[model samples]
Target: MKTQSVAIVLHDLRGGGAEKMMVRLANALAEQNTAVTMVLLTEGGVNKAELSSAVKLVELGSPRTLSSVPRLAAYLREAQPDRILSALTHVNVAAALACAMTGMLRRLVVSERNTYSLDKKVNTGAVMKFTYWLAPRIYRRLPNPVIAVSGGVARDLVETESLRPKDIVVAPNPVLTAKVLTMMDEPASHPWLQDPATRVVVAVGRLSHQKGFDTLIRAFAQVADIPNLRLVIFGEGELREELSALVSQLQLTERVDLPGYAANPLAEMKAADLFVLSSRFEGSPNVLVEAMATGVPVLATNCPSGPDEILDQGRLAPLVPVDNVNAMAQALRQCMEQPSDNAELKNRADRYRDALSAQAYSAVLNGSVTVWGR
Candidate 1:
């Protein structure tokens, strides 16, 4: 069988989860001999450096996602890729409109990387809120099922976005590449992570409210009695000043540190005593998966989607309620005292391996399979 020509539409090469996953999928598809082209709405993000040489990159030169629809439509008309995949809400809406204009709507597959309704939470600006509000209407025009990163996210689409159950497919985020496994063996990114004398609790994500780093910090303050225990959250965002203020207010200045974005979080996870994801909502947290892939113990909030599924309803690791400082504190104390089975965690992480996820997405992109029951 001949390989299909695929084009992935993304907002940018930003460090966000959706952007990272798209980059990995494009690279993996190219590595597997599929003709892959990445169509970025606007250029310039940290992930731009990570694109594989085999995969072609197309920069639309537009100022924003919606503004690129005309250019994207032109590309579809010219390149006429066999399959098209688009990520996130605004870009998905743009892709749907673009593909429709080019008479290629049937070839387009839009992916939802977060609980679709988080629009009410993540999109505060008027333009974004309206865009998200308009998404369901646009998504309904899709000829292909929307690919959700987790079952919870799929359910959200059906409930909030009014998508039919049959119109969604649950797919894993293509994390845990062979390169990540190698990176795990590298030295810890921070001196505290490398020090055997100190026990580190690591959380990686943007320092924003959605990530709930404030909850993590309060929980850490509650567990300060544990000697040699420290909390390190890696990632930068708009909430850096606010979160740093919280740390100071809680008097956790010494015990907690906000070391902005780690170049390789797996390396930090490899040396840590435990990993925590305190997100309020997630499609499927790649950081949690990365820690599990590193064979490190984890604790996460029982959010709408990803954590519960990844932890098997808390059978594999502890799951606390979102923003519940007491529950998070208790779990953190217990987890810091005793980590879970690394072998089992590693096994669960295997389900999201780059090869397996890439193959599933490949099937979707090629239209060889539909509704991969996840």
Candidate 2:
């Protein structure tokens, strides 16, 4: 075990749920005395700063997934990692190819962070479609079980991607790590959070069709008349103009605001009254867990993958139908009117502790364990 080293491959530490968890996982693995290296196709993202000093960062300096395969193989040949973990679909495919090129397929583990069916809906590029098409083929050929962030993602791999049940391992994202829980205690920078009189409804995600911010904005308009109510969506993406236009179209500009990328959404969540996840689909919905960890009331769209499991089938928090404006609106009103049990929320969030997530990954990489995130 002392001689073992793990290499985590991904497309830079971007501002995405999977990216955030991978960073936390790398940091946690380093803390456990495992030699860890983060191999990036590109070397920069907002989350890069969150990586621990102990974890080495390597840049392939390639533009995208397929182009980085040779560089990744070169890194593998030089570093000779005992195990490789890759996240996100494109990166997973690329890593598998790289591992295969280096004769290290048995040492590689691939993960699907979001529900692929939904991912396909949002990212419809011909190349992206081809990559998703290539994923199952590449993933199924690997010797190690594919790590999935949620049961839904696991199922999608089996159903949509044609992976065998024996090829799957469910692992929750490292959302409520001690570092993150501590970050939740940091001071809130948003002024809306400071006003106790204002009932703030916060949703954190990229402003893409997958996040369903347009649906959330429309839902917020339904309850906009509620005094002191305000909605703030955090994170940046390609659909900013479309979402902003919809917000204005609904005449919700006064009540709704799309504040771009938040370096520390948990801190803002700590101060907000409610946190909503309106994703069209998810693997584990890390933001939901983070909000619950902050003890903030949360509402989610009952999407294909993570929400039902994360919310314990709506026992932990309320879940609405995906893209149903009326149901989401009503849920929003009910959540805000009804104070949540902060203790219960935080306790539920603790199940995905960084230590536990890291332990599962470590075991998988060690080829000693199979199932997790139950």
Best by TM-score: 1
C-alpha TM-score for every candidate:
0.97, 0.95
Candidate 1 lDDT at 249 equals: 95
201-314: candidate 1 lDDT, tens digit per residue: 999988878899999998899899999999999999999999999999989889899988787788999899999999998889998999998988999999988999999999
The CA lDDT of each predicted structure is 0.88, 0.86
lDDT of 2 by residue, 242-324 (tens): 98889888888788888897768899988998999998877888888889988888889999888998888998888899889
* Pairs with steric clashes in candidate 2: none
After aligning candidate 2 to the native by TM-score, how far in Å is the CA of 360 from where it should be? 0.4
RMSD, one per candidate, in order: 1.4, 1.7
On a 0 to 1 TM-score scale, where does candidate 1 land against the true structure? 0.97
